[model samples]
Target: MADPPDLAVVSQPADLTNAWLTAVLGAAVHGFSYERIGTGQVSDCYRIAVRYAPGSAGPASVILKVASADPTSRQTGAAMGLYDSEVRFYRELVPHLGSGPAPGCYHAAIDAGSGAFDLVLEDAAPAVAGDEIRGATVEQARRAVTELGRLHTLTAGRPSLIEAGWLERGSLLNAELLTQLYTLFLARYREYLSGPQRSVCDSLVTAFDHYLALMSAEQRGLVHGDYRLDNMLFGARESARSLTVVDWQGVMVGPALTDLAYFLGGALPADLRRAHYDELLLTYHAALGPEPARTPEQIREAVRRQSFMGVIMSIAASVVVERTDRGDELFLTILSRHCDHILDTGALPLLITGG
Candidate 1:
């Protein structure tokens, strides 16, 4: 087969022509159609269905991800280098990752100045997306965490990746911004938030700087900043992988355990998480292998300390993203569970004592 022809980066679904699809897919395309997919707030996603000419072949369907239509969200994505980081993840990092948790990227391109980006990826059809409100089963949660372990294992200790400036980009949600956003979050959800949830938010907001400092001191590795149920797709019958993680726009080099904590803190209801927490942590720890060895206790402490990640995400992302009924519900669900996790694990003291 001949090499696929190069195509310019397309910023919107309307710009995706049959010829462009043909060139990128390395096949003769007859026609194509697209429909929007997902409830993404910072970006847009579409499922592109392609029809190939006789004797030529390619993916029957592929996923196309582009920048958000909302100006505020688009500007935030650009300013935070979210677009750049995702493109780089596909272009630079995915190849070395083998068949890990992330989807296979066919093409990745971005114009940094405009915050416009596009990614053509393998479609994980026949798989159901995990739901934050419904939560995950023990078996499902185990699969997700194991894959997360693989993601961390694959990316750990890579000099090229670690040295890459884009992967190491810092979050824009500083103390000042978080405090402002938290206030707005409280005002909007005041009626919805319980006293415990409100207390968690207030404590975190008051000690935001200290939390950042402590998190910075932890071991660094590639982290899926928003690792949670909503961002994941759990496999079904005939699926190649049990869990396929998507949405790398928030990918960064941060505390390794934060992803584990973020996922476990909200992916399961509090009671189930309490029952299976050790087994889940052991599953992740075992899958992570011996390199940069860590004990179960160490993992527990790290996850405990980093539990505030979910709280921060709930406040910061809820304020910034375009609002929807589902969005509001999802954010509140995340906040409530994470607050329970924080209180249950006694994580509040860490923030209170500035450790």
Candidate 2:
């Protein structure tokens, strides 16, 4: 890969545990002390084991997502206002978050201006059975789309979240967004992607400015910036269609279809995904009944127009879900076919070098 920026601190299990207890629980010396149980690149998810609290007889536990405080995170690349937007998002929409199957936030905080953030969250309402089940499911897809619709409904025009002490600016989309996305794609992909696939990528990158401009003019609303499968959990009991949208750090105010397209088109098998594509649009439209300038027809149109995003993502991004040796191999396999499909379909602007 590449050397990381200086600002970012490498995630160490011990360091994260200390930070969590000291920053979140130590002051009160609460019965619940956390142990770093889950470690992923995104956040250090901890199992907060509570032996006993004042009145409680036994124990309680919850999941905690510790926001990264690495200096490199800022220097190398990351969206600005993302952490703030997430804290703001949970605070604003908690009321609508019915117990159905979502993990409720017990408490969420962002340090004054430093952007160091933490969340004391209720455990996943219903634990997902396995990693395979963890992948996108039709049920989860429906629930996720509906939730995004509901969120957009709540924070539509309000420019500031008065009660939450935010400008209601939604989330900021900045240079880092494009830079990181393109970098992540161009680096690993250049070696394996066919000339035609690279052509499509280059073509899209060239047209990015116009694309953003067009999307900017749409009736914007809250977006789960990275609404992919892995960031979510199936509902506590109902089904995969019923799910709790987990990661919120990348929340933003933008075209709503961005999330829907990302999931259905990005994750599900092509045929199974296309099957529900239109139906999902109608479902989401029904969710957002009457927002100003937000019409169902237009939203549906946006879905179709921007739907090609999946194609761009398919070729540029390695299909591997995470950091592993197998991940790279898997990504190459998926991308190579994607490259073939694009070229055979006449989708590229120029043949990328060394197809």
The lDDT of each candidate is: 0.86, 0.52
Number of backbone collisions per candidate, in order? 0, 16
Query: How does each model score on TM-score?
Result: 0.95, 0.68
**Stretches of candidate 2 exceeding 4 Å from the true structure:** 1-40, 57-59, 69-79, 92-102, 112-115, 129-135, 156-184, 194-196, 238-241, 289-297, 308-355
Q: Write the per-residue lDDT of candidate 2 for residues 86-200, one digit (tens) a residue.
A: 6666666654545433356655665645545656666664555212222456676677677667655555545353234343443233334545566776666677766765665
In candidate 2, position 269 carries an lDDT of 48
Q: Residue 347: error of model 1 in Å?
A: 0.6
In candidate 1, the residue pairs with backbone N, CA or C atoms under 3 Å apart (3 or more residues apart, or in different chains) clash, namely: none
RMSD of 2: 8.0
Q: Could you tell me how far off, in angstroms, the CA of residue 148 lies in candidate 1 after the best superposition?
A: 1.1
Q: Which stretches of candidate 1 lie over 4 Å from their true place?
A: 1-6, 157-159, 290-292
> Per-residue CA lDDT of candidate 1, range 1-355, in tens?
1224456788999999888888789899999999999988899999999999999999999999999998888887887778888888888778888878888888888875666888999898879998888899898899988998877777775556656877777767788989899888978898998888988999899888888889989988888888888788888879877788998888888887989999989889899999999999999998887764688899998999889899999999898878889999999988999999999989998986855
Q: Give the per-residue Cα lDDT of candidate 2 at 49.
A: 68
